[model samples]
Target: MLEGVFMSFGAIAASYFTLAGGGGSSQYANAVLADNPLAFYQFDETSGTTMADSSGNGNDGIYSAGVTVGSYAITTGPGRSAGFSNDIGGTTDYRATVPYGSWMNTNELTVAFTCFLEPMGYFRLLASRYGEPGTDWSWFVYGASGTLRFHWRSSGGTNTNIDTGFTPVRGTKYYVAAYVNASESGIRVYDATGLVGQATGAGGTVNSSSRPLTLMNAATGNYTANGHLDDVVVLGSALSTARLDTLAGIALTPQPKWINRTAGVSARNGTTSHAVSFIPTSAGSLLVAVISTPAASSAVTAGWTKRVAAHGTYTECAVYTRSASAGDATIQLSVSISNVPLHYTVYEFPVGSSWHSSVSVMDDNVYPVLTGLPGSSPVTVFACVSDRRLLADTAGESVAWRYFWRTELSQETLYGGGTDGIFTGIGVIDEVYDTAVDVDAMDSHVETNGSGSPNRVVFAINVA
Candidate 1:
């Protein structure tokens, strides 16, 4: 029995089982209980709040309407979910007390949930004990996986995995159960099938007698899980194999696929080479296009592929471009169905190189203008000029003479060069405006116009 003395007799007040019609506060009446059982109140991005009564009076306090005999206290935060609660000192602002004072080394605790494969990333389902402000103890950290892996750790911060065993297949449901006990702490993953695999053999803090733990979807500024979570449950005591099976049988709450892709990406192209990259806003196969204004040298299509790698949470990709010459290029990334290889094209110049003078309407439209060079093969450097002009620095007075090619040309090429005082390329009288001139193609080449190398090269690419 709970610890509380009775004062008045039993009286049934108008219980608010159903949420008031029209509208109320953010709190909602999930169930109607004759006596208000102690509940953990949280209001953040993961778990939002709901109103109880229709007057919007249900702010963030412990209120007892049905039973007027004994009273319970609560800890309330102004805006978001505050720390834990002990109910001591009348719910002013105290941390939550750990159950049984502390954890028993022999005892155990486990949490289980269902997730999807939409937002491939990390999540945190913690067994935390709240105390003073900023003083919180977390037991486990786990979530969805793809190109990367997302798992949790104990007090020692050991990596404990929490995957569905089977690969994360979108539109499909999978269950992940993280177990923390005295014998050992491990994870058992399951897809639509029964049991996939068990990754036991990890050490963690044993919060046997911990406070009410919460399911936290935490992201460390990386890929986020885009999946649904349902049927969240906590075993009152250490769960056994039989108990785990029973709990898994129960229905769970459902969450939507998390879209964790960032806003955009930045990349560049190189002389006689093209660069590539893409930003995903959701979980789906995309088609990437690689195009050059005059077409690439080898007419080779770059192959691109993405998969769950790091931490098994986010998607990582790899693309390859064939040997090509100087040209204006762009890569367009698009999505298609699963199992189908990611579509991408390589746009290279047909005969000569092209240089972009100023920021044009196609500035952002061009994909591989400033892309990094590949490490495998050396790219022949070329620059297109309106009048076959020599590259010059911004000052124009500092005439560059010697050229230094890209040194950090591991993944991409970085070239610079030109002559300063006696320049004849820019004023070449009969030269065509769009003439492709092959410069020095080496590991690292510098463009010089004066005593030093050319300042910078201006280039343009077409998306169409």
Candidate 2:
């Protein structure tokens, strides 16, 4: 016979018990899918049964929240024990009290929990804030301390008690639930095995006087008791035993969705400087840009710009690899967005000279309003290298209109004969002469000894 006030599952495997006054291991007493998240705790004092005494270290005690934390403590008589046992042939005394707060209404109520003791002893769960002391509006106590029987007292001098020989377990999870439903008679008791006691009809009467429920330490007096408890659930609804067990069995993981998507991918390919665009193409979301140079004289500088298009020809977005050192440099590709979720796929052949910047656009976010050419949106990417110059496209037709692109590079008059203009030659082409290199972002200040040197960067736009 477990001889404690409550039984606690000590392992950290998601499920727990609240011996004395705690909400098991999850720290949440309630669990509701919609707006209800469990919130309850168990606490105990060094020696007393009051809330203040049991409030452990940190002043918040075992059952404390940011603002609304309560104190709880466990107490026992000389012959009491708070551990597991195979049989409950001995008598065990236990008590718990909420020093503060009022259980004024049915919206928030407190349920009772107890196990068997050779099928004898009184088990009372009451709420008392005012009026006639223990006989106030809060008169819900199950008197099952001696025989397998249950009794209830309500306001307006109403009372009812029933007898059911409940075969309680010696060491197990048991519950005595009370709530304000169409019939407040759902009061039930259970052992580790199954339901040991239940009322035949609605057994609880409602009182019009609104007073929070508070437990008296002893039914004979207005004080509280110090008892051990475990596995307490303060939920919005009374979950069935099967559902509760299922929840206790399942494990939960806590990570958002987006973090799983952008975890692994090279930053040095797909035309952007170390930044790959998840571009939706006729084929799929593929890496479609290269952002490095392959010759000493010709360096591939990559940059990207976004603009909200009230009216435009086609959807456009781009990513670039940070600039690389001159000669035999190209950002390589490793994976393609195939068999994955994408917004839309459109057809656009790669165009423009490898030296001249051009944008091969694709649809992202697939908004219905973006079906025409007028719907454009913008997003920002970082600069791989500052001081690298950019030149406007020589293709002056409306098809060559470059959108307003911004770079993080500081705007200073070029010194050291460094003019801010395009240095072309490392033009992208379908032919051979292959050499691709992935240059990681080289912090300009770090590589240049605090001397800001020009680094290769890419800035491109779609020219339809």
Predicted structure with the largest TM-score when compared to the true one: 2
Q: Give the Cα lDDT of each candidate.
A: 0.27, 0.27
**385-437: candidate 1 lDDT, tens digit per residue:** 11111233232321111111111110111112321111111100011112232
Candidate 1 residue runs with Cα over 4 Å from true position: 1-48, 51-107, 119-136, 144-165, 203-216, 219-224, 249-464
The C-alpha TM-scores of every prediction are 0.29, 0.32
Instruction: Give the clash total for candidate 2.
Output: 71
- Report the lDDT of model 1 for residue 96: 18
> How far out, in Å, is residue 94 in model 2?
8.8
lDDT of 2 by residue, 1-464 (tens): 21111222110111111234322222122332221323232332323333332112221212212111221211111111121111000111223333323222333333443322222244533323333444544434434543333344454456545555554433233454443323453455653344556653343444434443333223233322122243333443445544433333221111110101111223222232232233222221112232211111212233321111111121112232221222312232222221111111111222321122322212211111111111121111122221222232232111010001111122221111211221111111111111211112111111221122233332222221
Instruction: Score residue 56 of candidate 1 by CA lDDT.
Output: 26
Q: Candidate 2: where is the Cα deviation over 4 Å?
A: 1-39, 44-95, 99-103, 107-119, 122-135, 145-157, 167-173, 203-205, 208-228, 231-464
